[model samples]
Target: MFAMSNPERPVRLGFVGVGSRGTSMLQTALMLEGVEITAISDIVPERVERAQQLVMESGQPKPKGFTGEEDYKKIADLTNVDAVFTATPWSLHTPVMVATMKAGKYGGTEMPACDGYEEAWELVETAEQTGMHCMLLENYAYMRNVMMVLNMVRHGLFGELTHCETGYQHDVRYATIGDQGELLWRAHERYLHHTGNRYPTHAIGPVSQWIDINRGNKFEYLVSMSSRSLGLNHYVAKNYGADHPNAKRQYKAGDVNCTLIQTANGITVTLYYDSLSPRPVDFIYRIQGTKGIYSGTLDKIYLEDTSPVPHQWEDIEKYVEEYDHPLWKKYGDIAVQTGHGGSDYLCMRDFVEAIRHQAAFPIDVYDAATWSIITKLTEESVLNKSKPVDFPDFTRSKWRERKPLPIVNS
Candidate 1:
C-alpha cells in the first residue's frame, strides 16, 4: 500500500561483478521500467568492457565501469548510484555488501550471502545499524510453482503444515570446474571446504516465506549429514590434474547434504542441497498437512476434503490466477516472466522501493542472519556427524516485539 509516484528519473543503480550471473542481472535491470545503471565494477577488464557493451546494446546511457576489486568501493560509493547488486564470489560478498550498506546505499547479494556465520552476523548488524536495505537474492523463492505453493500455504489450503521437504539438486561441475578453472570457488574442494548444507538458502527461503518464519515462528535447531565426495573429483583429476596442483590431492567434491530443522512452532522442515550430482535441476518441495499433502516433485496434490474434489496439479495455473498471495496477487504476473520465475525482478523492485520510500525491506537483516546461520550450522552438524545443533537466538526475544511485516508495494 506504499505506492509512490514514478521517480522523475530512474533510480540510479550500480553492479559489482559482471560475470555470468552479474551480466544477466545487469541486462534485466536495463529492461526494467524505472532503473538506470549508473556504474559497474568488475575485477576482469573484459567483463567491464562487456558490461559497457551491454549498456550500449540496450540503448541506455553507458555506465562508468571500474576494473579491479579495489575500485568496487569507489563505484559503490558513487553519488549517482542509489543501489548496488553484488554477484561476487562467496568470500567477497561480505566486504562488498557491507561497504555498500555503509555508504548509505541499498544492496542485493546472491545466495549464501557470506562464507561463514560471523560474516553473516556482521552483514546483518551493518545493514541494521546503517538503515540500508540488504536483500539476499535467492531467486528460487520467486518461481511460479513455488509461489503457487506459497499462496496455497498462506490461504490455509494446506491446513497446518506438519512437515515439509525442499531441496536444490543440480549438477554444476562443468561450470564450477571448467569456467572457474581448476580452483573451483564454490566447490567443496576449493572454497566451502566443509560438509554441511552449504547452500540451504535457496530451498529454505521459500519455505520460510510460506511458513511466515521469523514473524510467527523461527528455526529452533537443525541436524545435518552429507555423502562422501565422488564423481566430480575424478573428472577434475583427469581433466585439470596438471593445471591445478591440488587436482589429484583428494578433492572433496561435496556430495548430497541434508538438514532436518525444527521450528519454534514444532513444525519440521527437511532441506537438501547437492551440486556434484549428474542430474537435471530438481527442487523437490513437498509439504504435508492435516487436510492435504502437496508435492512439487510429482506436480500433484492430495486433499482429505470430500466436499470438493481435490484440485489437480494441472490446475496450478488456475489456482495461481484465482488464489495468489496478496503480495503475489499484485506482482506475480510480472514476476513469472522475469529471471528465477520473476523473483529477481520482485527482489530488485523491493530494493529500489525501500530506498525511494524509506521503508524497511521485507527481508530484513535478521532474516538474512537466521538463514545464513542455518547453513553454517548445517555444516557444523555435518562435521559432527549430524548431531543436533542449537540455533543461535539472534533476535534474543526482539522478534516478539515486532509484528509481521506488512505487504507494502514500495
Candidate 2:
C-alpha cells in the first residue's frame, strides 16, 4: 500500500512546474474528484501564484507555494502529501521525481522521465526497492481512439500484431527562439545532440500496449537515421535576418530522424521525431496485424474478414459503440473536458485513484524506464551511421514472465 491510506478524503498533491503544460495538469487536478493540491513549486513565482489561485478558486484552502532554486525539495519533504505531480522541463523531471520517491510518495512525471539510461535505472531501482509507484504521465496512451484500437487488438481484431509505426511531427520554430531572435534551451538542445528520436514514448507507449511489449514481447534492437539539419537555420534566417548569430549556429540534431526498433517477438516499431519541420502536428500511429491493419491518420481499420465487403476499409467511428474502451465508456465525456481529448483527465483520474487506494499504477516503472531511455538508444544508432543499437531490458528477463496489464478493469 502507498503512504496514502485514506480514500474518503482528497488525495493530497504536491505539484512542481506551473508553466504552460504544468498549469494544464494543475487545472485537471482541480477538476478530479479525489485530488487536493496542497503544495506548488516552480522557478517562476508568478506561475506558482497563478496555479495557487486556480486551486483556491476550486474551493480548497490556499496551497503552500515554493519557488526558485531547490524549491521542489519542500514539496517532496511535505509529509501530508500522498503523491507528487511534476510537469517540469526535461532536466527537472528526473530530479523532482527522484526526490519524491526518496521522500516516500507515489510520483508521476512528464514524458521522457529521464534523459539517459543511468537516471532511468535509478527510477527502476528506487521503485523496486521501495515498492513505490512511478507512473509516467503518457497521455497519448489514454487517447480514446488509441484505447479503442488497443481493445480491438486484444479482442483479436488485429490478430498477432506484427508491426507498429508512430511519430511526433510538428513545426515549433517559434518556441525555440525568443522574440529578439535569441536561441533558447530547446533550440540549443538541437545543437547539442547529434541525432535521436528526442520524443519517443508518445508514439511508442500506445503501440507498446497493443503489441504486448514490456510484457510477453521486448524491444530487441533499433537502427536510426536522420536527414541533415536545415529547417531551423532557414527559419531563423527568414525571420531573424541572415546575419543573425542564431542563423549561424550549427545545429547538431537533424531536421528529421527515423528510428526502427525490432522486438524480441519480431515485432518492429518505426518511430520518428520531426519537431522542427514545416507541418501541422501529427501522431501518425499505424499498426499492422496478421488479420488486418489500422491507419490513425485516416481514422480507419481494415480486416481479412470481407463478409460485408472483403478487403474494404471500415471507418473506425462506426465501430466505436461496439469496441469503445471501458475506460472511455465510463469517462469519455469527462476526459474531453480536460486537455488532449480527455486523455489527460483519465490519466489523472487513474493516478489519483491509484494514490488513494494504493493500487499499482497503470503505467508502472518498467514501462516508464524502457519508454523514456529509448531516446538514448536511438541516438547511438544515428550517431553510428545507422548501426543497430540494443535496447536494454531494464526488466531483465522479468518482462517475459510478466503478463499484459489491463487498460480497464477486467
Candidate 3:
C-alpha cells in the first residue's frame, strides 16, 4: 500500500475536447488540490478558447490552448503533464487513451471507454504494457446513493443477493430537431441509429460495484433485447422532419435496450438503458436478496425477515454517514461539495491520489474493459435476437491472485 502525500508541486494535467462534459470535468479538476490545468485541446477553436477563458476567469493561470487532433497529441506527450483527461467523443476515447498511456501519463477517460470489443482489449493491453493507469471515469459509480447501496450489499444488509436491475433513461429528442441548419452531434437520431444499448455503463457500473463483480464474481454470459426505435423516429419526424434535409428519410427510433447477465455465482442481473423517452431522468437501481429487497425507484426497501412495511428511501448521504463504504468514510466528506452528487470530485481525487502514491487505481484496467465490453456484448446480443453471448474472462483467474481492494475504513 502507498501512503498519501501532498505533492510539493501540483500535478500538471491536459484535457482534450473541452465541450459540455469536458467543461464540467475541467471545473471539477480546478477545484481539487495538487492539480494544474496546464494545457487543453479541442477540434473546435471556439471550445478550446472558451475552456482557456473559463480557466482564466476562474483566476487560475491560463492554460495553453491547442486546436486540431494532432495538437491534442502533442499536448498529451508534453513532459510537464502528469496526466491526461479524455472527454472527447466516444469513438475517440480508445485512441487518445492509448496515446496517453504510451506517453507514460495516467489517463481518465469518459464512460463506456470504447465502442467495441477490440478497442477495449487494446486499451487494456496498452495500459498493462505501458505500466500506467487508465481509469474509466464512470461518474455514476461514484454517486452517494451508489456508494451507500454498495455498502449495504457489502455488509450483507441484503443477504444472499439473487437479482439486480438498473438503467439510465432520459429524453433529448428536441435537440435532434437541428434548428436553423445546425447539426446535432449528440442527437440520438444522428449517431445512435446503428448502435444498440447506446449508453450502458451509467446503469451497469453501480450494480457491478455493489456486487463486487471484478473482485469476486465475474459475468459469465449475457443476452440482450431491444424495443423498436419507434419512439425516436416519431419524435424526430414530429419535431424535426419538416425542415430537416433528411425529412424524407426514416429516422431510426431509439431503443429501450435490456441485457440479462448471468454471473459466475449464478445470480442474474437485468440491465436496462434508454435515451429516447419523454420522461424524468432516472437511474433506477434495484436489488433483491434472500433476506430483503431494496428498490431505488419507489425509494423504499423491504426486509423479508422483518415487518412488511417498506422503508422509505431516506437520503443516501445519511446512509453513507451511518454505514459508510470505507472509501466514503475517508474521502466522502471532502467530495460532497462537488458536482454529480460529489462523485465527480471523488473520481478525480481517487485517480490523482492513486497516481501520486503509485498505488493501484480504484478502478483498474480489467474492470474498465469488462464494463466496456459488456456494452458491446449487449448490442451483439440484441442483433442476434437476444442470443446468449459468453463474456471473455479478461482476468483469466488473475483476480484470485490479486488482493481485494482495501475498504478504507472497514
Question: In order, how many clashes per candidate?
Answer: 2, 2, 2
Q: Which residue pairs clash in candidate 2?
A: 306-310, 335-342
**lDDT, model 2, position 133:** 85
Which window of 10 residues has the lowest lDDT sum in candidate 3? 311-320
Q: Among these predicted structures, which one has the highest TM-score? A: 2
Q: Local error of candidate 1 at 267, Å?
A: 0.8
- Which of the two candidates, 1 or 2, achieves a greater lDDT against the reference? 2
lDDT (10s digit) by residue, model 2, range 91-134: 77878888888888999999888888888899888888878888
Q: Which pairs of residues clash in candidate 3, taking residues 3 or more apart in a chain or in different chains?
A: 229-253, 299-313
Model 3, 1-410: lDDT tens digits are 11123466677789998988899889888887877888999989999889998888777788988987767678767877788888887778888888888887888898778767789889888887888878888888887667777777767788998999888776665555466434375654233455456667788888887776777788899998877666555565566665555444444434577778999888889887777677887778889888877777865566655534455343334344566666666777767777787899888887777667666777778888888887678767877878999987777777556554544511
Q: Give the C-alpha miss distance for residue 244 in model 2, angstroms.
A: 1.5
Which runs of model 3 end up more than 4 angstroms from their true locations?
1-6, 174-177, 180-183, 187-193, 241-248, 251-254, 306-321, 324-337
Residues 264-368 of candidate 1 have per-residue lDDT tens digits of 887899898887777888788888788887778886677677324656443344465655556577777766666776777777677766666656677766777
- The positional error of residue 250 in candidate 1, measured at the CA in angstroms, is 2.0
Please report, in order, the local distance difference test score of every candidate based on alpha carbons: 0.74, 0.85, 0.75
> What's the TM-score of each model vs. the native?
0.89, 0.97, 0.90
- Residue ranges of candidate 1 with Cα displaced over 4 Å: 1-8, 179-181, 188-192, 237-247, 306-318, 325-337, 405-410
Give the Å error, residue 109, model 3: 0.3
